[model samples]
Target chain A: MARLTLDALRTILVACAGEDDGVDLSGDILDTTFEDLGYDSLALMESAARIEREFGIALDDDDVNEALTPRLLLDLVNGSEVRAA
Target chain B: MSTQSSTAAGASGRRVVVTGLGVTAPGGIGTEHYWKALLTGENGISELSRFDASRYPSRLAGQIDDFEASDHLPGRLLPQTDVSTRYALVAADWALADAGVGPDAGFEDYDLGVVTSTAQGGFDFTHREFHKLWSQGPEYVSVYESFAWFYAVNTGQISIRNTMRGPSAALVGEQAGGLDAIGHACRTVRRGTRLVLTGGVDSALDPWGYASQLAGGLVSTVADPERAYLPFDAEASGHVPGEGGAVLIVEDADSARERGVERIYGEIAGYAATFDPAPGSGRPPALGRAAELALAQAGLTPADVSVVFADGAGAPDLDRAEAEAIGRLFGPHGVPVTAPKALTGRLCAGGGPTDLVAALLALRDQVIPATGRTARVPDAYRLDLVTGQPREAALSTALVLARGRHGFNSAIVLTTHRP
Candidate 1:
């Protein structure tokens, strides 16, 4: 299976909830928290829903909430097995 | 005999005036465009293009074809809000800019407030979420649905965006809710708030929203745009559903003058709302009572009003009731009456504020826009209905009326600021 790359995560984040004008997502943003990145909890939830649909993964709500950074979210997505429909 | 005034009379000493207006209606996006459309007697009702409305019986709507939300709002707000709320946010921005009250405008966050109305909330947003819940499971639904579909979402979003921490509220009287919102904001200003962003904006043209409107049984089924909605006419059947409305900067007159605001639209001189008696109660509709009380609150007689912006529900019984109320107050064909909604259809909660905007502009320009294409007026109705062409008159004061489905009736009187 292909891994979820940082570029793919950036695309999902911008597509789900727009990017903040002040925040630069192009640089090293893997360790930065979503709160500092200007994306609120609701925005993260929306991004998670979109990522789940695209990656064919079912993420636990609490687990998604705990994954607050891009690095963590990428690891979580790449580690999960594609659920059978 | 003097009319009995409601609690609205307590704020009689503190005058409230409209300083700025922002509109996103069917025919136009801004106040200038809207006014020009009204003057030219342009109609905005057309076949619904939001979705595949072919399956519905009543497919025509007063849709805003040119409003590209991306042009007016930021991308972050795009995902958070629905179409109706987007309209309101843009309208509020325009109104605040028009009033010259921005971040640097000296007014504190606590002095500015927002009081808006919406009948169905964000139907488009809610419908999409519901589809996900049924098809892709509950986890797929967006978290914004928690408040996005709420009727008070407009007020909340407007207040939050502008950081308006002053007295604010949200009303839901269906069509009458728009005027009710303005009236409440006037009261808030009288209590010493500096300014209030008031009025309403609503859009529910999606399949679910359209179905809800059809369930009301008040929508006209005629496919022709011109003949679909005719108010005060013998052939009046029902109204065509439409979307969008107006938002106004209602400020304390003294505060507005202190701020050096030059263009004052008009003073919100009087306002009153009343509930109708139960059906089959052998009692009359309270629309006339509401009008009389509003005029009395303004210390004006029926003759003082130069023109009337009527509700014009465009249904037989509703039209007759509104006409009778006008006749009782202004006598038979005593004052010029117009319902520009004939062009835009009934905009639900947005309808009343839109009419109020028309009244204020008419008072400013001394012209009454025609009731677009509603020509076959029944003589028995006794309304001096303005049709075909805009009527130029020496207008000073204008009376606006609105009635909701479940027995809500509201009346507001706007007079020239200098007068």
Candidate 2:
């Protein structure tokens, strides 16, 4: 498995939230919560599902709920990859 | 000249008037757009593109195009509801705003109510959820699925969102549900509630919804848009299924007057409902009985109704049964008949309320809009069906009719608000 770059992680987060180029999915907003980013629980659930499918990793329901910020979700993905390797 | 009791609430037998109307239909999104397109006799039927209908028996429907919920509703509502519910929310907003009430308005003090009817609620959403359950897993299903597709979701959601703590209810009478909702609201006001938000919203345009409707065998399979849904014509094949609805604010006449409501659309003069004979019962339908009973309730006779909005089911026997009923009541060409559903298709639960809006508009404008695509009334019927173009008349009272698939028949009478 390759390393998860910040840019790649940001792109994945953008696609997971079903957002287009209108949203600035960059490191500057990594600390922002999904709710602040205009993404509701349903949107975040869908984003988590897409992330799990793409990363070949299993995500816990509680983990998804606790990962309120984009950076937290990225950390979960990177941790899952490290464990897998 | 009347023995009806008049209370402080102005219960002249508890008179109820339609104070405001909101519509989202196939041709347009608002009431003005609906009435304009209706009067112009524009065709709203087209190929069903909401889902893959290539293999379905019925390929055509009155699908609403370019309906952006975000454009019509608030941001918070975007993720909470299905297309049908969103349509209902937008329509409710229009109705409340039209009635000079809102979420923060002083209407909260009054006994306000809501009754939204639907035969098929959250069908598209349910279909999507079922697909998720089948293809993915139960865990993938939306949490909103539990209430989204429930028949009462509209009533519940509308009541909660608007903070209407009065007697809220959901009517589940199939196509007659819309009229029955208003009928029930009228009765409720007569019993005591001051204001009622009532109407219907339905969308069955998805694969699962369309498949279920197709199994019912009443929808037109005709590929031609122009010849698909001819309600009263000899060439009438079958009805087209459409998605949309109308919401109306029905307030006690006295309350509206006290609130200084300037323009009351019309009074819900009378309403009656009856059942049709079973499919193989070998008996004529009782549509005329419902009409007569409704008219009698309004303290009116057959001669009083200025125009008739026929149920216009579009199936041969159904159309003939309705025509026979009109002939029996109106004495052969005595009343002008029109079925504007030819333009918007049969909206099931949504049709009755939509027709109510049309009837009120007809009363206001004194013009009966033509039935689209039905060039000729069948020769066997001695009814004066409006077609080709709209007809100008001294329209003061209108009769709107609706019939559900399984024996439900409803009639509602609306009279212009005479101050």
Question: TM-scores of all models?
Answer: 0.95, 0.85
Q: Give the best candidate by TM-score.
A: 1
Encode model 1's per-residue lDDT on B1-419: one tens digit a residue.
Answer: 22434333364467899999999999998988988998987899999998998989899999999989888877778888999999999989898899998888789989998999999899999999999999989877888999999989999999988899998999999999999999999989989899999999899999999999999999988889989999988888799999999999999888889889999999988899999999999999999999998887777889889999999999999999999999999999999999998988888889999999999999988999999889989988999999989999999889999999989999999989872
* Candidate 2 ranges beyond 4 A from true positions: A1-85, B1-12
Residue runs of model 1 more than 4 Å from their true location after superposition: A53-68, A75-85, B1-12
Clashing pairs for model 2 are none
Task: Assess candidate 1 and give its TM-score to the true structure.
Answer: 0.95
**lDDT (0 to 1) per candidate:** 0.90, 0.84
Local distance difference test, candidate 2: 0.84
Candidate 1 lDDT over residue span A2-53, tens digit each: 6789998999888888877778999999999989988888898899888888
| Cα displacement (Å) at residue B304, model 2 | 0.8
